[model samples]
Target chain A: MNLILLSPNDLLTDNRACIKNPRQLAHIKQVHGATVGDQLKVGLINGNLGIGLVTELNDTAIYLDVDLHQAPPRALPLTLVLGLPRPKMMRRILQTVATLGVKQLHLINSYRVEKSYWQTPFLEAENIREQLILGLEQGCDTHLPEVHLHKRFKPFVEDELPAIVADTRALVAHPYTETACPCQIEYSLTLAVGPEGGFIPYEIDLLEKCNFEAVQVGERIMRVETAVPYLLGRLF
Target chain B: MNLILLSPNDLLTDNRACIKNPRQLAHIKQVHGATVGDQLKVGLINGNLGIGLVTELNDTAIYLDVDLHQAPPRALPLTLVLGLPRPKMMRRILQTVATLGVKQLHLINSYRVEKSYWQTPFLEAENIREQLILGLEQGCDTHLPEVHLHKRFKPFVEDELPAIVADTRALVAHPYTETACPCQIEYSLTLAVGPEGGFIPYEIDLLEKCNFEAVQVGERIMRVETAVPYLLGRLF
Candidate 1:
């Protein structure tokens, strides 16, 4: 963990907090090899980042005296609308989006998305938060990305999506498209990426109607986990 | 599997091939749902991509009338120098590099790289090839990337790295650097990415002496797997 993320409940005072979670404690002792009086990078959830001076270090917890002074990095000016991936890839995808500074993520259903994927326990709020927190720790950020789910395709695209795409450069990543995915664009973007096989023609047509232009990355197709970072790097 | 990749061993004649492997057979039957006369995308290993018409299909094998014609997508004009990732991540990294069209990859040792990483079975030729093949199948490409291992860092940098970086833009992704990574450069590149926790100052200095510029992606620190795709997207 790059940053010791503290929740409000962990606070003993405005400046004092205790990291009692086994996971964080283990990481602190084992990976970090931190001891008392050593300062560590720390951040408060939805707040600022700073340093935590290790006041007490033991097996159970590490008590810290924190100073919150620095702001987190800027969030990406993009909204990701992704076709819900396979259940196995869900955690990594959530972590990736969070690490890449994606503040808004919409996991929607597509023709190629298996119905069973929506039933995965990975989509549970607690489970999702757990993954996102891990991502924040890796990325060393404070703000969390908001994830929204839409189980139905057409209704989400027809009703909810238009408003989201209104002020952005709407795009859908497709292999069949001739237009290359634009690079280093200055404007905000709302990008939609399909599942394994890709969005069906009817789905593409519906997105097109919502002003989303189909863009191709390259001839070689990438898994969604890889594609998200690739797209973000190219665009932002 | 997006394309049925055929090795020379799989070919029965110039115009025919039979897939008897359980993996391919299951994918063709269960995923593609192919039957006699059904056409599927096919590609020869390190050769052209084309179509395979199913001539016979059963439990044991799927016979095809092969017609290889189209060339595979262009390979990226870049060489990747990566600190050998953890054993568990090695398979995915190999697959990702291949899927992204990277043809030359050097898995080198770094100060932060664990000594045990060098001992992974994933570094074996057959295991590496297996992951690369899976990547090619996922990417719908034919050419497999060449992976080289370097157990010693100093010798590789002093002796072999200069020639590799001579005709290309040499860059090392370092989080401590002030320079932001460039984008959309129309030139070949040789990129070195460190293992988790990054290269030590001495290592960075050595790279600098060899004309490698240290560049940063952003404030957020990403896992090596995520960083590779991110770097490729930004550079290429």
Candidate 2:
């Protein structure tokens, strides 16, 4: 973990907190090999970046004298509208989105998205939060990305996506598109990426009607996990 | 599998081939749902991209009338020098490197790289080829990336890295560096990325002596897997 993320529950006072989670405890002890009096990079969730002075180091808990000041890394000026991926892939994508500093993510249905994917327990609020927290820890950030799910494709695209695309550079990643994906864009963007086989023609048409221009990266097809970082890196 | 990749052994004649591998057979039958007379995208290993007309299909094999004429997707003009990742992560990174169209990859040792990483069976030629094939299939490309292993760091940087970075834009991903990574560069590049905790100062100094300019992506620290693609996307 790059940063020791603190939740309100861990607080003993405004300036003090304790880390008791076994996973975090194990990481701090084993990976970091930290000890009492050693200062660690830390941040409060949805708050500011700072340091935690290790006041007490024990097997059960690591008490920190907290100090908060600096802001987290800048959030990407982009909204990701992704086709709900397969259950196995969804877990990593959640972490990736947050790690890349994307603040807004919408998991929407698409023709190529399997119905079974929507049924995965990984979509549970607590499970989703766990993955995002891992991402936040890896990225060393404080603000969490907001994830919204849309089970229905039509209503989401027709009624909701328009406003999301209103002032942004709306884009949909499609292999068949003649236009190459733009690079190093300065404006905010709403990027839609499809499922494995890609969004069907009718689905593309629906997205196009919402003012989303289809763009292709290259001839090579990349999996969603790779594409997410690839697109973000290229655009930003 | 996006493309049925054929090795020389699979070719029965100049115009015909048979896929006897159970994995390929299952994917063709189940995923592609191909039958006699069905044409599927196919590519010769390290050769051209074309179509294969299914002429015979059975439990044991699928025969194809192969016709290769078109060239594969353009290869990225990059030579990746990466610190050998953890074994589990190595498998995925190999596939990702090929999928992204990098043709030359050198997995070198770094201060942070665990000694056990170089001992992974996944580094074996046949096993590495298997992963690269899966990547080519996923990417719909024909050319397989060449992977080289460097068990020693100092020698590789002093003896080999200089020549590799001679003409190309040489960059090392260092979080401590002040220069932001450049994007949309229309030139060949040689990029060096470190393992999990990153290369030590002494290692970075050696790289700098070899004319490698260190650059940072942003504030957030990405995992090696994420950083590989992120660096490639930004640089190219």
TM-score of chain A of each: 0.98, 0.97
Over 4 Å off, model 1? none
For residues A61-108, what per-residue lDDT tens digits would candidate 2 score against the true structure?
A: 999999988999999999999999999988789998888999999999
DockQ numbers for every candidate? Answer: 0.87, 0.83
The clash tally of candidate 2 reads: 0
TM-score of each: 0.98, 0.99
**Candidate No. with top DockQ:** 1
lDDT of 2 by residue, B137-201 (tens): 99999999999999999999999998898889888999998999999899999989999988899
lDDT, each prediction: 0.93, 0.92
Model 1, range B53-105, lDDT digits (tens) per residue? 99999889889999999999999999999988999999999999999999999
Clashing pairs in 1: none
Mind giving the per-residue lDDT tens digits that candidate 1 earns over A92-120? 99999999999999999999999999999
